[model samples]
Target chain A: MYTSLFYKEWIKTRRPLLLLSAVFAATVAYILLNVAKLYQANPVALWEFIVQNNAAQAGYLKYLTLGAGIALALVQLAPEMQNKRLKLTLHLPLNESKIVGSILWFGIVALTGLYLASGAILLAGLTVYFPAEIVSANLLAMLPWMLGGLAAYLFAAWICLEPVWRQRVLYTIPALGCTSLFYLDALPGAYLPFVPWLASLTVAGFAFPFYSAIRFKQGVQ
Target chain B: MNAIIQCENITHYYGNRLIYENLNFEVMPGKILGLLGKNGTGKTTIINILTGFLKPRAGVCRIFGEAMERLTPAAKSRIGLLLEGHIQHTYFNIEQIEKFYSRFFPKWKREAYYELLKRLQVTSTQKISAMSCGQRSQVALGLLFAQDPDLLILDDFSMGLDPGYRRLFVEYLREYITAENKTVFLTSHIIQDMEQLIDDCIIMDYGRILLHEPAAHILNHFRRFRFTSDADEIAPADGTLWHTEKVGNNWETYSFASAADVQRTLADGGAAVSGLAEERLSLEDAFIGLTGKY
Candidate 1:
């Protein structure tokens, strides 16, 4: 049964997942290509330039990662909400919580996988020109952005499953507030001390979708 | 016979407006029961309660001898549901959806589903979203049949179906019920399709059950009566009469009692039964008579 569910979701999400991954990878490659071209222009100035303006690089990636999270959540949940098709899955013999949890988890996994893949490629590409410290610093800076992506996915799922437009807007407020914390300071590795707690909290954001699914089953508005 | 479905004192409300109070009904084993009501009369509300989609404000509903809200996975496997508007996972095509649902049901009958699908002029590769409303309904029904459940609950099955499609769907359902002898609980405002299909019925009006009896019994005992009365006079308020509406000086009343009983009630009320005639009524007429034309 679990395999069937996974396969069903795979079919529905495969197109969007591929398209999103391609778009993200292209953005990362474009940024790195510019970085490499700058390094070729003046080796000494390139290193100094990146070290001083590292936060600007982080800013570019942060918004991209957040956008990816919102896209994944929309791709996974919007159709189910469209015609109240979620009721079809709720009618299955499986537990309601388990069904909704599985969907949220799947989105999280897919988002994390794509985010990590793009991040790794960019890291490896940068390593050829920059020192290990700079490369690792950039990776640390990207962690909070990825965390924001997961949080956004969960929050968007909650918003999509919510029946009332008013409640959905209410949910978005807290989600935006939570995500804003990750973007507060763009210093490379600034959130490193809090990564463990942030990761745990990001995972806990999944509970919102569960609550939404329950209210949906109850036909609440 | 065992009660496949039961609701006791099922009271529900939307905010402060009471939709129904102390509403009760049952679906006996192997019997097809139709919950008939006009728009906003709580037919769909009863269905939602039974399906555990909406928990009633008060009262309890049991399916297969267990509370619907807490039915176990095994208990759920014994039931089949066809939601309103014949909603399905439009993402998957015919073969893909069948394969997906086949794993969840222990008694999944692939051939049963395919056999029904064959009757439709749709390809196995056709996605449900692209199909017409009638085609999608057939697919939904086919999926339920493949599950081979002990009970079937269908809500507003005729929502967007054309006349020919509606008839086809009803015929297929009738054949399935007769062959399997499974219990069915359905709600439909469209009465003609359900007239010959339901073994028993519960008609609702003004948040109350107007009639609950075997179809044969309701047909035999309950009837419509028209009698002319003086303009200043009112019709008799007898317990047996379910609803009464007057057009000009002529009064039409629906009664659960026999024709003779109706005449006796009118005569006792000091209203002469001079033009009293028992009008033949189909189930649709009986529904409108019980729920009135609003």
Candidate 2:
């Protein structure tokens, strides 16, 4: 049952997943090429600037990661919302929670995988031109952005699964408010001290979709 | 025999407006029951309640002896649901959908699904989203057939089909139900199609169930009566008559009473009647007669 559920999710989401992967790969490559140009101009100056300013060269990644989360959520969940098609999923001969869980689980796992690959590529590219301190600072800066992506994905699911428009609007407020915390400062390691809080917020966001699913099942209008 | 589906005193409201109150009905085993109602009379509401999508304000609905709101996965396996407009997961192609659903049911009839698809004349790789509404309906029906469920709950199955597809659906469903003796509870705006399919019916009015009986009984017993009367105003003295109206000197009404009883009741109401006639009605005519044209 779980395999079939994932298979159905995969069918609905594979196209968007592929499209997002290509875009993310292209964006990461572009970021790496920019950093390489800076290193070629003056490697010593680039290293000193990075060490002194504590900045991650890849600022474009912030919105790319966030946009990927939002886009993936919309593609994965908006179809289910159309024509109340989620009823088909709920009607399957399985536990309703398990069905809902498997759907969210698939999106979360897919997003996590994409984020991991993109982050790994970014880190590996930086390692070739910079020392450990610069790479570690980049990693620290990127972690919160990835957590923000996860939070955005889950929040989008909550809003999309919500059956009523008024409630969905209300949900969007917190969705925006909460995800904005990850972008308060762009400098490398700026959010490192608050990483645990940001991660906690992302973890808590997973529960919101289940609440929306419950309302949907109750036929709230 | 236990009822295949039962609703006891089901009451529900939309915010402050009452959709229905203390509504009750049951579908007996092997009986094909149709829920007939004018729009906004809570037909879909009942379907939602029965399927555990909408929790009612009061009362309980049980399917296969389990509460609908808490149906076990085993219980759900025995039921097939067709939503309004024959909605399905349109993202998957014909074959992919079949493969996706086949894993859930132990008694999945893959041949049954493909057999119906062959009639659609579409390739297995064609996505359901690309099909016309009628074609989508057939796919939904084909999926239901493949599930091989014991109970089928269909909501407004005739909403978006041409006559040919509607006839095909009704005929195919009739044959399947008869051959398998499956219990079906369904509603359709097209009462003529339902007339041919339903063995029993529950006609609903605003906030209540107006009538619940076998379709054969309703057709054989209930009738429309038209008579020309000399009196200026004729009215039924009792509640037996439904939707009594006067057009010129001609009076028409629907009732379950016999011709003799109707004549007596009119005479008692002080009408001098002539050219009294009884009209045997189709289910659609009977429905309008019972519920009125308004």
Candidate 3:
């Protein structure tokens, strides 16, 4: 049942998601090429990239990996809510947590895939143009950040979609706060887990709201 | 007959606003219960709560004697529901929906699904998005029949269907009920269409159940009485009160009980009476009488 929900969500979202992915890939490719050119033409840009990204690998991972997670999260749920299709799913004599959680799971998987593709392109650019500071450990360390971002994204979705006005506005404010954290890129690991505004704004994202089966029970008869 | 569904004081509230309160009702085995309600009534809300789609604020409900919240596999297996609107993943063809649902419901009968597909005259390959509104509505009914449930709950039965399909569906449903002794609960705007099929009806308004009785009883006991009353309104002590309207110095009152009590009262008041005739109660009249608003 869980897998079917995921598969259904995938079938519904795969087209636009893949299309957006292709667009994201093109944009990332452009950014990577531009970064390489800046490094060769004016060494100052090289110092700037190092200063910005090398400070904390989590910050870079939180923004890029979480951004990817945000896209996937939106791809999974936004249309369902907009079209009121979630009612169809919830009406069935099934567990809402798993139904909603399965969509979240698909989003996490999709984001992980995006991270793999984007990371490859970024890594290749670093290897050819500037290999001085790009380490494999630094790359490996971004996994927690990616997972954390995914959790935060799902958490925001849960709170925002309470099917009531107060909860709707309630879910909206926290989401705004988290997205702001992602944009600022200065959020530390200690604060990331609590950032309900987004999926990747925290340390492990699990702390934000990890599909607490408790929530669905209260709502359905 | 055993009650397949029972609700005691089932009250539902959205935030602080009470949609309905103190709702008590039941559907007995081998009986088709018709839910009659005007627009904005809580008919759909009750269905949603029973199907476990929406929660009630305070109430104890049992399906097959098991609490709804528990919703065991055995209990859930026995219940089937079709919400007010016909919903489908428009991009998916009817066959795809059939295939997907077949996997979900453990007791789903493949042969019955095909049989219903033929009976409903729906092509398996027709995508829901591509189908006309009426065809999609038929497809929704097709899915419900495929489940072969013991307790079936439907909301707005004839909302978007043509008269021809409506008659065919009712005929098919009648046979299905007789053959299987299944319990059916339906809410619809057009009570006339279901007048022959439903065994009993519960009239609802503003989330309140105003009346519950056998369809035959409603037909036999209730009537419309037109009389002239100089007073603004006359409240009769006895009989089922339906609705009242003032025309000039006269009043036309529709009552579920025999009009003898109300007619005698108006005559006792010494008001000039004419058109003192008994009118047959249409479903629309029964609805208006029960809800006051058309």
Every model's DockQ: 0.76, 0.86, 0.25
Which candidate, 2 or 3, has the higher DockQ? 2
Number of colliding residue pairs in each model: 0, 0, 10
Candidate 3 residue pairs in clash (backbone atoms < 3 Å): A149-A199, A149-A200, A152-A198, A152-A199, A153-A199, A178-A197, A192-A202, A193-A202, A193-A203, B242-B289
- Give the distance in Å from residue A214's predicted Cα in candidate 2 to where it truly belongs: 0.7
i-RMSD values for every candidate model? 1.0, 0.7, 3.6
DockQ for candidate 1, please give it.
0.76
Q: Which digits, one per residue and each the tens of the lDDT, describe model 2 over residues B41-158?
A: 9999999999999989999999999998988899999999999999988899999999999999999999999999899979999999999999999999999999999999999999
Q: What's the true lDDT of residue A115 in model 2? A: 88
| C-alpha positional error of residue A21 in candidate 2 after TM-score superposition, expressed in Å | 0.7
Q: Which regions of candidate 1 fall more than 4 Å away from where they truly are?
A: A55-59, B229-232
C-alpha lDDT score of every prediction, in listed order: 0.85, 0.91, 0.67
CA lDDT, candidate 2, residue A193: 83
Off by over 4 Å in 2: A44-53
Which 10 consecutive positions of candidate 1 chain A have the poorest summed lDDT?
A51-60
Off by more than 4 A, model 3: A31-64, A82-84, A128-132, A137-148, A179-221, B13-18, B111-127, B162-175, B227-233, B247-251, B256-265, B268-275
Better-scoring candidate (lDDT), 2 or 3:
2
lDDT of 2 by residue, A4-80 (tens): 99999899889889998998899889979877887899878776767665658666688878998888888888988
lDDT by residue (B52-74, candidate 1, tens digit) is 88888999999988897877788
